[model samples]
Target: MKPRISMITLGVANMAKAIDFYQNGLGFPRHGEGEQVAFFNLNGSWLGLYPKDALAEDAMVDSNASGFNAFSLAHNVGSEAEVEQVIQQAINAGATVTKTPRPTDWGGYSGYFKDPDGHLWEVAHNPHFWIGPEDTPK
Candidate 1:
């Protein structure tokens, strides 16, 4: 199998609210026009938002679950300052800061935020890792 993630789909409780949060608030580019579902083009992948119950139905699972899902989405940046900037951006977009930006044990910097749907996102800057195309150091 190819080692690539083409997209990450988030099951949101409110489709329209989610769309507004991602598209308008967070400035994610909307792929198409609709309130039923939303898709945003990322640097190397895509982010999708769909109704929670509908997504669960498509996956043939119960949608009555809540709380942490033991998973999180990450956005890696080019610099430590960018991490803080992104965190603030998420906050201005109505996300709650779960962790303030700080130095990490791995010698990097990172922080966390929870979107309106309560999905966790980690914004980080890894000095040892190249974040852009062609593996070029940022």
Candidate 2:
């Protein structure tokens, strides 16, 4: 199997709301105009949004799950300042700020936010690591 993630599909409670949050609020460039689902082109992968119930049905799981899903999606940036900026952007885009950006015990800076559907996202900056070329400051 390839050691790369091609896409991350999020089951959103509201398609339109999720689309606006990612496309307009977080500035993810949307890829297509499909109403049933929305796709965004990321730096190296893709982010997909589909209705929660439909996604659960497709996966043959119950859709009534709530609370933490026990995982988080991370966005690594080039600097501590960038981490804060991204977190604030998410907040302004209607996300709930779960943790304000701060220096971490692991020697990095990071923060957390939850999207409209309660999907947790971490915006972070690690001095020792860089995830991708897009994380480089221009």
Candidate 3:
């Protein structure tokens, strides 16, 4: 089994609003025109949005689950300033700021925000590690 995540799908209660927030708000390049689902090209991976109820039904799980899911999606950037920039972008896009960008104990800077559906996301800058191409240095 290859160790790679090809996509991350978010089960959204409002598909149109979700699409707008991701596409128009965050400036994610969208792919396809399917009415039931929205897909965004994330450079190497993909971000998908699907109806919450349908997603739960497809997984054969109860859709009544609420509150924190105990997980967060992170976007790593190249610098501390970029961390704040990305967080601000999320804010302008209707995300609720959960944590303002600040220096971390791990010798980095990070922040958190919740999307319209309450999906937690972290924007971080790690000086010790870079997740992009090997030729690119942080």
TM-score of each: 0.94, 0.94, 0.94
Report the C-alpha lDDT of model 3 over 1-138, residue by residue, as the tens digit.
Answer: 968899999999999989989998889999998659999999789999999999999999999999999999999899998898888888899999999999999999999999999999999999988677564544
Candidate scoring better on lDDT of 1 and 2: 2
> Between the candidate structures 2 and 3, which one is better when assessed by lDDT?
2
Task: Compare the candidates by lDDT and give the number of the best one.
Answer: 2
Clashing pairs in 2: none
lDDT (C-alpha, whole model) for all candidates: 0.91, 0.93, 0.92
lDDT of 1 by residue, 1-138 (tens): 868899999999898888988888888888989888889999789999989999999999999998799999988889999998999989888999999999999999999999999999999999988467668545
Per-residue CA lDDT of model 2 for 1-138, tens digit only, reads: 869899999999889999999999999999989669999998889999999999999999999998779999999998998998999899999999999999999999999999999999999999988888755558
**Using alpha carbons, what is the TM-score of model 3?**
0.94
Worst 10-residue stretch by lDDT in candidate 2? 129-138
User: How many clashes show up per model?
Assistant: 0, 0, 0
